[model samples]
Target: MGRQSIKFKRLTPFFNRQRLEQQFSFQLTATPKAIDKRFIYSGQVTERQIHKRYGVIVSESSETDDYVLDDSFLIWQGQQGLVIITGCSHSGIDAIIRHAKKITGNDKIQAIVGGLHLRCASLAALKERKSNRSPC
Candidate 1:
């Protein structure tokens, strides 16, 4: 066997404005990585119905359930029901599901994908994981 040189291809940023508009009108974007702030993209995807749903809330909670108010979600409506895609679900899954069904008028949850933050799992459940029945 002989050693060989590998060649790599340079990739360029490609954009077709017409094609993109046909699919999804660009929604609000938050580029900042800070937990305390959010910034929207300054592109021309001006649809009033979309932009009204996004922003930041600065209030804090006295309860232990307090979490970031910037937790947003993406809901897709299909023939069966709504498919919810969320980040850390700080507002709770039940609340999110309820809101989705109310907004879309679909009670059936076709699918839910993302972290549901089960920080309150019971001690027995945790112990079960230590047993052979459940692997780490």
Candidate 2:
């Protein structure tokens, strides 16, 4: 017999509101856009735009350096490749794309949406400046 594993947890209206709110602080809010695409879907779930509203913090490397565990959305496109959506790409967009390609084994990228936190040279320097730099 072949065993199948479910990869994701579906959030539905019938879910336990109190438990979810206690654990994850669920809030009723507005929706900017919605798409129905099987198990994968896209939506503008937050009003905050441009720079990330939170989670971005300064690393010990520099006082001005910003870092974030960027959240990404992936959708496989048949012939065009994968569509990537990001929320403040602190790891660099190119890096993200490369990683996606490597994981999905697809070279084509159909589309990219959301914020790309590109900084000026000065900002980049400040951000990259760390007390203990490690060689890769």
Candidate 3:
């Protein structure tokens, strides 16, 4: 298989709701933006680096340290590269897969599981067949 991408759940209507949480309505001809001004997508996280929740690192584009993670892989022994799981990826599943490959230094995706979050995904299934090329 080539690579896989899928979404696990549907986001609330207010998922994309943008509110002025902070006060930064200053003048800006060409000023830099902060992370809070963006929508962070924590794709289908499956691990728990801490001791609470099983993470589902979603991919996102931000100026902050890291609002989202492109890699949802779990390092078992070496590297499995099982699937590129994500949920409602605002940054796009394609972009997320690309980042995973780059970060893992591998082009093989085992499987994909999660929501693509495409405008038309509501009327379709995002499950895809991999090309049988897993990271070595």
What are the Cα lDDT values of the candidates? 0.50, 0.48, 0.41
Error of 1 at 9 (Å): 35
CA deviation > 4 Å runs, candidate 1: 1-66, 123-136
Number of the top candidate by lDDT?
1
TM-score, predicted candidate 3 vs. hidden true structure? 0.32
**The best candidate in terms of TM-score:** 1
Tens-digit lDDT track of model 2 for 1-136 = 3333333455676567776777685433232122343113322222122343333244446333223433444444456557777766655555666655555566776776677644454766645632212211
- Against the true structure, what is each candidate's TM-score? 0.42, 0.39, 0.32
lDDT of 3 by residue, 1-136 (tens): 3223445575575444254324335332221122232212232333322232223444554222333433332211124443555654544455556655554455766665676444464333433312222232
Q: List per-candidate RMSD values in Å.
A: 16.9, 16.8, 15.8
RMSD of 3: 15.8
lDDT of 1 by residue, 1-136 (tens): 3333334443643445666778877544532121222221112212221222232333344222223444566676666666777676666566666656555556777777787655697878656534622211
Looking at candidate 2, the ten consecutive residues that score lowest on lDDT are 38-47
Ranking by TM-score: 1, 2, 3
